[model samples]
Target: MTDEATQRLQDAEEHKKSYDGIMGAATEVGVPGALGLTMMFTSLVMANGVLLSILAGVAVYVLSHIIVKMFFSHH
Candidate 1:
């Protein structure tokens, strides 16, 4: 171990957080939003069709994207 180890630790602590761009923020919110809206539509007025199917696809994509971004973003 060297005397500069503490300095290295300090530098590591100062590292910047990962950037969540516009699309990233959108996915994180949009996935749940779509899922909720679908549920609401199903509950009220009682209608089902392509809207629900599309929301399902979006939900899956967003969730997988989030998982991949979370687990594989390390240096």
Candidate 2:
């Protein structure tokens, strides 16, 4: 009975590890997928002028980085 319990515990741990791996993979894939979709939408919306679109994108990106850094520094 002790041996059986040990085996069962090991099996449960292996399953937990596999579940964590799958969740990690899903998180990796989902982030890029969402980013790609958002980029596509932004491109379509700003399709009138490439220069303006690029400038706006860069401005937003820089501002976001600054904001994030500012908030992060407080911690």
Query: Against the true structure, whose lDDT is highest?
Result: 2
lDDT of 1 by residue, 1-75 (tens): 575998887666655322445455655666556665655555444554666655655665666667756864673
Q: Which residue pairs clash in candidate 1?
A: none
Looking at candidate 1, the ten consecutive residues that score lowest on lDDT are 14-23
**Whole-model lDDT per candidate:** 0.60, 0.62
Residue 8, model 1, lDDT: 83
Residue-level lDDT of model 2, residues 1-75, one tens digit each, is 999999999999999999878865554444444544455458658674666655555555555555545654643
TM-score of each: 0.35, 0.47
Each prediction's number of clashing residue pairs: 0, 0
